[model samples]
Target: MALTLYIDTARWRAHQQSVVQQFPGIVPVCKGNGYGFGHERLADEAARFGSDILAVGTTYEAARIKDFFSGDLLVLTPFRLGEEPVPLPDRAIRSVSSVEGVRGLVGARVVIEVMSTMKRHGISEEDLPKLHAAIEDVRLEGFAIHLPLDRTDGSDAVQEVAGWMDRLNAARLPLHTMFVSHLKADELARLRQQYPQTRFRARIGTRLWLGDHDATQYRGAVLDVTRVTKGDRFGYRQQKAPGDGHLVVVAGGTSHGVGLEAPKTMNGMMPRAKGAARAGLATMNRNLSPFVWAGKQRWFAEPPHMQVSILFVPGDAPAPQVGDELVAHLRHTTTQFDRMLDH
Candidate 1:
C-alpha cells in the first residue's frame, strides 16, 4: 500500500530559497502534519533552511521534531492551567496567551500573545497588563500576533499591529522579538523599518511549504482494479455499478485524510452559487473525487473507507491497471502521507 507525497527536490529547495530571500529570519511553521509532509521531515527540512527556531502546534508535536531538529522549539498553543501539563524541553518557548497561562508558567521562557483580529487564540489588549503582572518572575522572550488571512495584505492590518505595539509600549513591557502570522512581505518590511529594535519572526506554514504547487505532488498506488458492468455490486458497501466501467481501489482514504476537506473560503455570491450547484450534484451520487487517471477525475463508488478509496471510471474513459499509480489533488494540511518520494 502506498500513499505518497512526491517531491521535486530541486524545485522545492529553489522555492524555499526564494522565501528566505524574500523574508529574512522567517520561522518555518512545521505544524499540522507538516502540511502533509509530516512534522519530523519538515523539521529536518527547516534545519536545512538554516532556521534557529521551529514552531509546532502542541508539545506532543514538538517531541518528534525536537529529536530531529536541535533548534529552539516554540509551541504556538499554550498549555492551559487546568489541563495536565506536559513538561516542555528547556529550549521550548511557550505562548502565554492569558494571565492564567503566564501565572501557570512561572520562570518559563514565553512569548506573550496579544489577541489579534483573528480571535482564535491569545489575550485581549486590555489583558496584556494582567499578563504582564502574572509574568513577574517569567522570562518573557517576545510577543506574538495572529492576523486573519483575509486582512493580511492591506495597510489596515499594519495600523492594527501598530496599535498593539502602542499598547505593549504603554504597558511598559520590554520585548525583543515578535512572532507574527499571515503578514505580506511588503508589510513585514515596512514594520521592520518602523520598529528596528524588534526582530519580527514570520511564522509561515502554507506559504513556506506548499507555496509552489509545481514543486510537489501527491500520489497513491493502485491496489487493485475490477472490471464492472451495469448492476454489478462491488466495494465494502456492495455498491452497484451505475454503468459499464472499472472499480479502481487506491491506497488512500479517511485514515489518510482522503475524503476530508477544509472549509472553503467563499468570496462572492457567484462562488456560493457554484458551491451550491456542486453540492446538489453530489447528493445525486456524482460527487467529484480527486484521484485522476488518463487526465480525468474519477468518481467514488461510495464514501471512502479507512485505508482505501474506490473510484469509478466511465466505460468510454481509460482506466488505470493494478499496480499503477494515480495522482490526487488534495488538501495537504489535513492529509497524512504514508510515503514521500526522493529526488
Candidate 2:
C-alpha cells in the first residue's frame, strides 16, 4: 500500500520555467516535510530552477538537505541556548529571533526575523541594544522580518512593519540584507524603498515551490476492491457500505494525518417555520470534508487514515479495478508518503 504524489514531468517542467521567468533570484523554501515531496527532492528541483539559495525550517532539517543542495542553506528555526544535541551545519545561515539567540549566534551568519502575527521571537525595540552589545563580538550578517498574512482591513500589516522599522532604526543595526516571508512583490518593493540600504530576500514556500494549483496532482492507488453486501460490516468503525457496490480501498488513512479535525466558523442562522405548532428551527450543519475524489467535484469522503482511505466510487460511472489510481487532495504537511515519481 503506497500513497504517493505522481508528478507529471512535462507539467512540472513547465511550472518551473514559468516560476523562474516570473521571479528572478528566487530562494526556494524546502520546509515542513517539503510540503509533501520531501526536502531533498525539493532541493534537487530547486537547483534545476537555478536558485542561488535554499531555506530550511530547522537546523536538524538542514542536516538532511545540506548534501542534496550545493547552494547556501539558511535555517529559519531559532537556536536555543541550552537545547542539547545542537545542530551546527557548515555553510548554513541561522536566524536569531531572540536577544538570547542573537547573543548565542556570535560569529555565526545570522538572519534576524521580526516575527509578526506571532509575538514569539525576535529582538524587541527595547531589547535591540542589549542584543547588539551581546553580539558585538560576532559578525552580524543581516536582518530579516517574517511578514504575516494580510487582513481584510490591511492595517495590521502596515502597523507591524512600521513598528519593526522603527525598532531597527532606533537600534542603528547595520543590516546588509533582509528576508521577508508572506509578502507580495509590491509590498516588498515599498519596504525596499523605505529601507534602501538593505537587500531584501523573500522566503516563499507556497508560491515558489507549490505555485500552480493544477501543476502537480496527489493520487492514491486502489489496493483492494471488493463487493460488499449492505448489511456487511467494514472499516475501523465497522461502517457498513451504504449501498450494494464495490468497496474501494485507497492508499491513505489516519496515520498519514488523515481523519484529523480542524476548526470552523458558524453563520448562526435561524430558519422560521411557517404554521406548524412550534415556530422556529435552528439547524447546525457544520460537516467538514477536506478531500474530494477525481471527476466527481461535489462528492467527498472523510479524511483517510495513515495509509488508507475509503471513497464511494459510483458503480454507474466507470468503476476502478484493483491497483487503480485515484486523485486525493492531500494535506501535505501531515502525510509521510512512500515515494514521489516524476511521470
Candidate 3:
C-alpha cells in the first residue's frame, strides 16, 4: 500500500471524450506532473482523444511526451539564447514570447504568445512590431495567449481576448490562428463568431483531465499507528499532544506534495476569515493535513517528511487501524502518486 491514485477508467475516458467534442480545436496541455495523472499517461490519452496538437511546459517534457503521443508538440516556455532544444521530429512548435525568444529560436517553428493579464510571459502589445521584425528564419505557426484564471467577470473574457486580437491585427502581422487558455464556453463561442477569420485552439488541461472529480481519488495507506495520551511527548519536535489521540503515520508528505500550503486566494469575507484562522494556527506551528480518517480531516502531528506524513487523530474520532488507507484531498499538479490504479 502506498500513495495511490485510484481512477475510474470508464468515467475518465467518457469525460475526456465529452470535453473534446465540445471544443473543435483543443490543444491538450499536459505538463507539470501531467496534472498528477503522469505525463506519459496523459500523452496517450490525448492521442487517444484524436488530438492533433499537444502543449507541454518545457523541452524536457516534449522529449518524453513525443515517445508516446504521435501528435504535434507545442512547448509553452520560450527558449533561451544559445539553448539547444532537444532533438525530436519536426512536429514540435516552440513558443516565442519576446524579442529575445524570436532571436534565440531562429529557424524554428514557433508560436508568439501575446501578453495577457497574467503578464508572467509573452511579448507586450506595444512590442508586437519588434517581435514581428525579429521573426526571421522562424516559421510563425500562430499566436498564443495564456489568460489569467481569475478573470470571472461576466463577458470580460471575450472582450479581453478580443483586445489582444485587435492589437495583433493592428500590427498588420499575418496571424490567423491563436492558442488560448482559461476562457469560458460562452466566451469562446462569441469569440468564434466575432472573428470568423481567426482560428482559436483551446489549450485545455484541468477541464480536460480533472473536470470530473468523481473519476479520480487519492488515497494514502496507513504505515504506522501509535496511541498516545495528552501529556506524552513524541515526534521529532518532542511536542506533547493537546489531548489524548493516536499518531497516524501515513504515506505521502512533502515529497508527494502533502502538507505544503500555497498562498491562499481570498475572495470574500468568509474566505478571509478562514485564512485568518489558518494563519493563527500556523503561527503555533500546528497545521492541518489533507488526510481524512474516521470521517474527519486530521491535523498534522508534525511537519511532513519527504515520503510520509504524521497525522494527529483525536481519540474521540474514529481511529484508523494499521494498513488502513485514508482518502487525501490533494492538488493533482503538485502530488506525486506512487501507484495508479485503474478499473
Task: Please give each candidate's TM-score.
Answer: 0.94, 0.83, 0.93
Candidate 2 per-residue C-alpha lDDT over 1-343 given as tens digits, one digit per residue, 9 for 90 to 100: 5767777777877877776555555567899889877887889888887787899988888888888998888888877787665565657888887888777766787777776666667666667777758668666657777765646555655456757777777788776676777766666677778777767677778876577767677666778777766666776667655566666777767776655545433333432222221212212211223334446621223335556766655456556777777766666666666668787
Model 3 TM-score, 2 decimals: 0.93
lDDT at 69 for candidate 2?
Answer: 91
- Model 3: lowest-lDDT 10 consecutive positions: 149-158
Model 3 lDDT per residue over 90-170, tens place? 899998777887887768898988888888888887787786568766888998888888755644777888998888888
| Total backbone collisions for each predicted model | 0, 12, 0
The residue ranges of model 2 lying beyond 4 angstroms of the native Cα positions read: 17-24, 115-117, 156-159, 261-294, 297-306, 314-318
Cα lDDT, model 2, residue 211: 70
Pairwise TM-score winner, candidates 2 and 3: 3
lDDT string for model 1 (146-248, tens) is 8887853554877878788878888887757888888889989988888898888899989988999988888889999889999998877787899999889
